[model samples]
Target: MKQKELQIGNLTLRRPIFQGGMGVGVSLGGLAGAVAAAGGAGAISAAQIGFREPDFDTNTVEANLRAMGKELQKARGRAEGGVVGFNIMVAMQHYADYVKQAVKLGADFIVSGAGLPVDLPEYAAGSNVKLAPIVSTEKSAGVILKYWARKFERVPDFLVIEGPKAGGHLGFTGEQLTSFDEAAYGEEVKRIIAKVREYEARFQKKIPVVLGGGISGMEKAARAFALGADAIQAATRFVTTEECDADPRYKQAYLDAREEDILLIKSPVGLPGRAIRNVFADRVMSGERIAPERCRGCIKGCRPTEIPYCITEALIRAVKGDRENGLLFCGADAWKAERIETVQQVVDDLLG
Candidate 1:
């Protein structure tokens, strides 16, 4: 099959691929810009995006909000007019404000997940920024689309299906992730697409569906297209790319990973995630809990004293190359990374 461009409203991405948003300094403007310049849509993760800002420790909110615009600017500088957007999680403590800020900064699109972004339209009101809600199952998709239609009289510009094999915080239960059945999941994807089509028909507009999670290469991408996806989102595959915003050591971890090294972990936010097994993860899995030294108030309803470990700090450490002490969130196929390739090379390999 020939490569197709992903279309959302009037926007066009030369390659039907999305560089999935990795967080805590992972997918930043540099990486996103490179992907967009390479012909695919690029997404900058808004999770703790301002960690590198000097005032982050003192004025976390301000620093993060400030960083958002700066990151968008950086991406635009390198996007070459290609599609570039932000991936903001609904579970964020300042989710509403983040959405509002993103629109104010003129983000081309905003893809939200980590919870049902039911009020996303409201937050992005009066803006031309396209919106997308990330969902893993048909129920969530139906609920979001129906709610948006009833409440906002609109449908999403696009939809992202974060499959069970995705990294970081997942939408699936531990049981579901452990007992994943590809054929069964493919049926789920079909149902979700069908549900989106219902809204598309009602609104008389196209709503592209993008599939992600464990999209390691062309074969998996082909499966996603077979499942009715208009595009594929890949995070882990991008992590090993030279343009990725992560430190060299972070890329090294992916290169060194083996099939047995990746494991499913329970995140502090009460969600199951995939990561590379290491000392930090092993310690936590052994029933040892460490209190966060400081609270950035990143996630909603998260109590610093009650969680297993500080996700922000751990991810920061990982991005800075402290592999043994930080969280190494990655897709199930992280072990397959053989070397650090350029963003253009990876995109061509996957979309060609």
Candidate 2:
């Protein structure tokens, strides 16, 4: 039989798959809970999840805090005692606050990225929540593991290797993304896995490594497993699922996209991101300045005046059915979505 279980610490995931957290109201309670109940590790994105709350414009931080609890409660209710996690970006303002809150709410895992989550263990200290960091290169993997081992005397429960083809803010540079080579990245993943082993030896524990980015189907997943991955993480594949929280229009964007429609653009948060070719992306590429009316203050270093457009607004629009004006972030293979399926269907198709 194929190895179909992912073990970390005392937890065993029957599906050996992670529903990569897609945000801006994309993967929330419905999709996450559905995937978890289907025997996979379901994840929710904690980025501006409160934008739907009425007071988000006025009390942004408070709105988000409330939403964190609200969504987790909903997910827990729907999960049917299955495992559920959150994807909280390290670039968000009050980053550690979200981590601490998620743990308090009984979130089983917290997957962090968009920056080196060096101090994640600080916030998750004394909690039952497992911590994992997203890294795309061996250097980053080594730095993060070495830092955690020395400072907290802890290692990641698992590692998420996000390759270049993933959506939203990526971990690679523009130069690196354009010249992306699959074989080279496979080698990089192996190197990153080696770094994880070094820390695993130091801590005397098993640290599973998961491969992410453009892995949309079984073929790619099998390749990762062959390369020694304990499991795989995927976000774009879930976007078109019926249980996904994003508006139907957002899901349509994935169904309507072409392979050539995927483009790399700079996020105001100071990183390169992958998105579909739409009016919003075109405007950004054409240097049309879409100024922000007010700062919701999401990311830490984002200066309202410095960025061309308000990322929060664009994403908010994306999730609320404003397709033409919103940023549709997706993996390079998003065009492969034929129709919206159930969350269970997606998990079954990927891992069955």
Considering summed lDDT, which 10 consecutive residues are worst modelled in model 1? 1-10
Q: Could you tell me how far off, in angstroms, the CA of residue 242 lies in candidate 1 after the best superposition? A: 1.0
Candidate 2 per-residue lDDT over residues 130-245, each given as its tens digit = 99999999999989998998899889998899999888999999999999999999999889998888888878999999898888887888888888888888899999988899
Candidate 2, residue 85: Cα displacement in angstroms equals 1.1
Candidate 1 lDDT, tens digit per residue, 1-352? 4577777887898999988999999999999999999988899999999999999999998999999999889999997688899999999999998899999998889999999999999999999999999999999999999999999999999999999999999999999999999999999999999999988888999999999999998889998999899999998999988889999999999999999999988899899999999999999899899778899999998989899999999999999999889999999999999988999989888877
TM-score of 1: 0.99
Q: Tell me the lDDT of candidate 2.
A: 0.89
| TM-scores of all predicted structures | 0.99, 0.98
lDDT score at residue 155, model 1, on the 0-100 scale: 93
Off by over 4 Å in 1: none
lDDT of each: 0.92, 0.89
Query: With candidate 1 superimposed using the best TM-score fit, by how many Å does residue 175's alpha carbon deviate from the native?
Result: 0.5
Off by over 4 Å in 2: none
Best by lDDT: 1
Candidate with best TM-score: 1
